[model samples]
Target chain A: MTTTARPIRRRSAFMRNAFPYFMLAPAVIFLLGITLYPGIYALYRSTMTGKFKLEFVGLQNYRELIVDSTFWESLYNTLLVGSLTLAIEFVIAMTMAALVYRDPWVKAWRIVFLLPMLLMPSAVSYIWKLLFNDGRIISDLLGKLGSTLGNIDFMSSTSLARMVLVITDVWQWTPFLFIIFVAGLQGMDKEVEEAARLDGATWPKIFFNISLPLLRPVIAIALVLRGVDILTMFTPVHVITQGSPAGHTETVSYFIYRTAFKSFEQGYASAASVLVLIATIILSQTLVRRFFRSGTEA
Target chain B: MNAIRKLTLSLWAIICALPIIWFASIALRPHNEIIAPQPIYFPTFTTETWAKIFAEWPIMNYFKNSLLAVSGSVFICLLLGIPAAYALARYKFKGREDIGFYILSTKMMAPAAVAIPMFVLFGHFHLLDTVWALMLAYAAMNMSIVVWIIRSYMMEIPHEIEDAARTDGASDLRILWSIIIPMCMPGIITAAVIAAIFAMNEYLFTLIIASQHAYPLSVALANFSGGSDGIIYNAIALVAFMAFFPVLLLVILIQNHLSRGLTMGAVKG
Candidate 1:
């Protein structure tokens, strides 16, 4: 009887150990099959040449990517667009967040503020495309401003086209950052802030030294998430610019789309994709870790 | 200070609403007014544009496709994500942290990184140009978000209730179904709503993996811009309005949960 009871106990313990894996199985299997497998397959295909007859080119695609002027330009454009969007979005979001944090009426207005972010990216692009039309209100206003400088076609000129892309991105994403910062502000310890005020600390001093430090983790999370998104921006460029004016407005993701679809250079596109994947992984991992660590210490 | 705050807030609100208001105005204006040399700030209202959009384009077909794809993908995400979320929330499992991080890392991988290979794979499986391919791709893309959001909510549920149920001889699946699910229903709904929105908005994968047969509103609206006649402002505006309205309704309905939903429980107020 004692031996039998011991064996049954051991069996129950084993089942308990196995239960979590059973629960986790479906998600893990689906992710691995759909996402990870395709990524690995893309890496493998990147080293090959030719589409139906397929021969292993062994890094030839990468070699071309190294000296590819178009690729370089697209990369530069991606960084430029990404950084500008990040900067503009951050400043506006922070200012708006500071103004409206804990204000009841403004709090009620958040729903309206989030409309652009909530709309489909494709839809956002379409809206902006119309606004950027030569005779549209936005273009008319900018045109008036441009007469002082020079002629301006928002979608045709290289610099203005890029600026339009950045503006559209900022309009859509600022509310995302604003909402996060507002939440961060609401979550702060009011006692500490009040104490600082009682101790004669000025508003700027308290904000720069206290509130900002406490909000670092939230800020970090927002930056990394939005950065990844801005880097992969495709819809606006695809809809509004289509890399017009000699590919000046082409983002890296749009460049990949053109290569694979228009040019039918699947191998070269795959090579570029692998490079993108590496860069994204490295950037996210490093930034998240670095910010999270500093946030905790602060 | 109060006056300044009100002015600033009002100004920002106008900036925020300007594009959407402008787009809607174009959709309502007559065709001639849309193409005039001067900008039409206010034009006579007409439904001609909307009538033309519905009459000429397969707008209903695209809407149906989008609805089916978004609902299908959200259902799949919940089906797979709930159990995994429950496991991470309740159970003490080895490799739990690693698994959570892995799921999140999948979200960081840009869709373009795998779009070419997915196109090739779909070609082999004959899944290209079908709603099934879009549904599957979106389900995989959104599964992590479902897990993260639901898991955070599930963690807030008291453990003793589950323990009490177990002591009454309830199985793990039985407890999850009978006890845990009803309590966590709100979280599940939030996750589903957010996932649905994301799936509806997806463009890159849909553009690459689907042709006309499974084209969603996003793709259809995009193609409208590139049509042979080229860039009719009113037509594009009508299509854009139609595309944005459903999402606008959803966001307003769930405004209270919008920030929490978007952040995936990261920055809760």
Candidate 2:
């Protein structure tokens, strides 16, 4: 009985050891097929040209992107719009989080705030389009206010078009930062605040000197995540403006979509995508590494 | 201070609620009223636009496609993510940290990079323009989120319970099924809900690959526009509301877990 049990026990131990790997195998394989394979294929495709019969182009696509003024314009627009959206979202979300943090009467209002973020972004873009279109809600409201905003075409001017993009993004995404900031605020050590209060720190002083400093990690993580997402803003650009005013408001994602799907310039699009991928990885890696380090420490 | 606080709170609340209220109002208003030179604040509400849109477009077909593709992806995400999450939570193994970071990094990848090759590959395999294509794309897109959220939840469960089950000679699979899963039901549900919301809202991949038969609500809504009569604001609103309503409901249901969902489990609310 002992000898028979030993062999079965050995087999079971092996199975136990292999269990984790067995569980992880499917996800790993699936992710590789979807992410890694495509990523490597994009790299290979970036160096080639032609539709049906492919021919090698070496660095020609990259060279073309370097010279393409529209490519540069799209890149600039992405960064400009990205920064504007992040700045507005951070300010509004932070204010709302600060005001309502731990307030009993206002606690229920959090759900309402989250509604905007939960709306489909595509739908949000359309809603904004309806609001900002010529002779629409925004123009009507502006006209009521006795301003010339009613006559101005928001989608025709580059700055105004970008503003519409930024507004749509902020309306949809501010709640993401709001909820995270609220969570961070709640997760803070109450004792530290109590100690600060006991030491006669004013509310502003406490917020600036104590709370803001302590919330740095959460802020960094939130901003990094939001920034990365904003880098790929496409739907608003597509649905609201279609990069109107001569592609002045075109984002990199939409530009890539047009290049690949519209023009069938697969190789050129792949090159642009690779550049975007590199930028994304570098941006996320530094911030994510710090986050994980702090996470493990906590 | 209390008056000031109330004032600030209500102001922000109005800011948040007004757009959604107006959107629903638009969906129920007459077409001429919606696109009038002056915005009609108190137009007579009607469902004629909704009726018109339903008649003109295969709105239900698109709705069904969205439901099928999103639900299919959510099912796949959980099927693979749960076991992978369990492994990450319970085991300390070689390359564990590296593998975990890789998964998280994939979540950050731009959709464009993958979209190009995926479009080509799907066409190559004759899988383009199908719900199955959307399912596979969305599953890959959201796998990281499902894994991370579930893993974070799994970590919250104490290890002693699992150790006891192990001592009783329960197999790992049996323990996970009978012990861990039932305990982790809330996490599982949250992951599924969040995954569904993201999958349902996904536009780029679906737009690039799905044409006629596979157009989810997102694509269909984007393509829906004013024909010769000018921009049809009311009909667009109806379709937009339809696209978002289901996820909006799911989001409300998982309110407590939302920060975790949005941040891919980086912050717990």
DockQ for each numbered candidate? 0.51, 0.60
- What class would a CAPRI assessor give candidate 2's docking? medium
Best by TM-score: 2
How far in Å is the alpha carbon of A220 misplaced in model 1?
1.0
Give the TM-score of each candidate. 0.93, 0.95
lDDT, candidate 1, B1-269, per-residue tens: 87998788888889888878877787788777876678777799998677776788787888888888999999999999999988887887678766766776677778888899788888889999988999998998899889877887788789899887776667898889998889988788888888988898899999998787998877877666455545666766676666677777776666666566666666666
Scored against the true structure, residue A31 in model 2 reaches a CA lDDT of 91
* lDDT (tens digit, per residue) of candidate 1 on A70-102: 999999999999999999999998888877875
The true-versus-predicted C-alpha distance at residue B231 of model 2, in Å, is 3.6
* Candidate 1 CAPRI category: medium
The residue-by-residue lDDT of candidate 2 on A62-131, one tens digit each, is 9999999999999999999999999999999998888888698545879888878767888888888888
lDDT scores of the candidates, listed in order: 0.81, 0.85
| Steric clash count of candidate 2 | 0
lDDT of model 2 at residue A178? 94
- Cα deviation of B179 in candidate 1 (Å)? 2.2
In candidate 2, stretches whose alpha carbon ends up further than 4 angstroms from where it belongs are A1-14, A293-298
